[model samples]
Target: MSDAGKLRIDKWLWFARVVKTRSAAAALCEDGSVRLNGSRVDQAHKAVRIGDVVTVALTGRIKVLKVVSLAERRGPFSEAQHLYEDLSPEPPRFEPPSPVAEREAGSGRPTKSERRDLDRLRRPDD
Candidate 1:
């Protein structure tokens, strides 16, 4: 809060709660999964300032955010939300995944009938 102009991207990510930890954020950046202002950046020490746009390849989808302000520390979700403005593209339509065979915990291997059912699910031509 003292000076919002001198913040690093990795720190901002952690401060904004985009990642669970600063090390994780640094790793995300160092892996070339982060783009700053449309250019790929593979360094955790890159400086980020207000109004800069960052596009990141996250686990499930890519996210784009605009830096709105700097943060001094990792904070609550509500506080983190104030650090950046989300500009990510709308995600594609949801498609529920095919049902998977599930059994109770500690149930061990599938029973004969269950195996047959699973086999049928695996190969509809069966």
Candidate 2:
């Protein structure tokens, strides 16, 4: 493709608001946390064109985006959103375990209240 038809991956990431800063995007690319069309991207200057799939690994989740358009400058979220079509899958739901006090009957040791009641019952008349 011609030069005009492509843009550097780092620039595109920043322009699309996928990352907070261009330097972060470059660091992500250098860290091999970015993938272009399923291939690892180790350089910030790699060229990306419309219709390419870009996968980015973030702290707790991964983002999959398809290039829909290119941008010339960083813009507002509404404008940036148009630059890519999000294809990321839904993140897994997390359900915290029930509290220890809510455990099933006879599952574990008695609670403090239970122990207090027991002690009261065991005490002689006084």
Write model 2 residue lDDT over 1-126, tens digit each, in one string. 122588999999999998999999999999999999999999999999999999999999999999988888888999898888999999999989756435467778977998777667667464
- TM-score, one value per model: 0.74, 0.75
Global CA lDDT computed for model 2: 0.90
Top candidate on lDDT is: 2
TM-score of 1: 0.74
Q: What is the model-wide C-alpha lDDT for candidate 1?
A: 0.88
- Candidate 1 C-alpha RMSD relative to the actual structure: 5.9
Counting only residues 3 or more apart in sequence or on different chains, how many pairs clash (N, Cα, C under 3 Å) in candidate 2? 0
Candidate closest to the true structure, highest TM-score: 2
What lDDT would each prediction earn against the true structure? Answer: 0.88, 0.90
